[model samples]
Target: MEQNDGLWQALDAMAGEATEYFQKARLLQERMAGITGTAVTDDGYIKVTWRDGGIDGLEINPRAMRMGSADLAETILRLSHEARADSRRQSDAVMSDLFGTQNPAGIVADKEGLQESIDMMRDVFTGAIGDSKDLIDRLQRRLRQD
Candidate 1:
């Protein structure tokens, strides 16, 4: 029947799209994994390097030591926060660019049947930002005690 043929064609098209989406996402993930970078504070006393999900390196200039313990700590904390925020922002941008505003697995594949999956990702990013901010605040507070 023509209806049966049409159904198969539609399914085939969807399968192809899904495959492309996954391949692209995987490529982006791999590209992101090896990207390492550093950020420096305005005072030139603190620098932080990070890759993937953790701190890769840290450098504290001798100039910061002259600022006393508290100032030195604050400078380091601020630089760390800046580096983390910058990394997260970049990661989010990459995800957004790769997935687009409408998630391929959601709207493109099943026409809203996967809305929950999309919602879950949004929650994940929201929670990540909240957690990152909390962590930065904690670090700042702890450093201020020095």
Candidate 2:
């Protein structure tokens, strides 16, 4: 009976921690979804906005039309790349703040990290429930024998 009480206490503590971890992960995802990045050409001829892994907006000055087709296309591509890099940096910063890690890539909970966490939690709860069921069976058997 004493052993069963200790096991229940441990399971309760783990469940509480798992709940807190899940809430924090959800908050991080929401923040990352809302983040955006912007970049403007050095000549101020073009501007690009990046949000949620896609370009959200763009602006090109009329004077930029003077350039040949290739020049204009090149400028847009360069600005888009810059905007993407800016967005990635912003994302890294947010992730770093949340996880408190100096290494961005290591701590960022990408698809793999999120999946691993979910799997681990599932396994823990599964094991706890299985243990409780086995314990109850053993207790019932002992009571019947008595």
Alpha-carbon RMSD, each predicted model: 22.1, 4.0
Clashing pairs in 1: none
lDDT of each: 0.71, 0.82
Give the CA lDDT, 0 to 100, for residue 129 in model 2. 84
User: What TM-score would each prediction reach against the true structure?
Assistant: 0.64, 0.72
Candidate 2 clashing pairs, residues 3+ apart or interchain: none
Those runs of model 2 whose alpha carbons end farther than 4 Å from true positions after fitting are: 101-130
Model 2 TM-score relative to the real fold: 0.72
* Candidate achieving the largest TM-score: 2
Please identify model 1 stretches exceeding 4 Å from their true place. Answer: 103-146
Q: For candidate 1, write residues 1-146 as lDDT tens digits.
A: 45445555655786897798889889777867866656897766778976777778898877767788887777667766777777777776676678777544336568455777679768855665666666678789989998
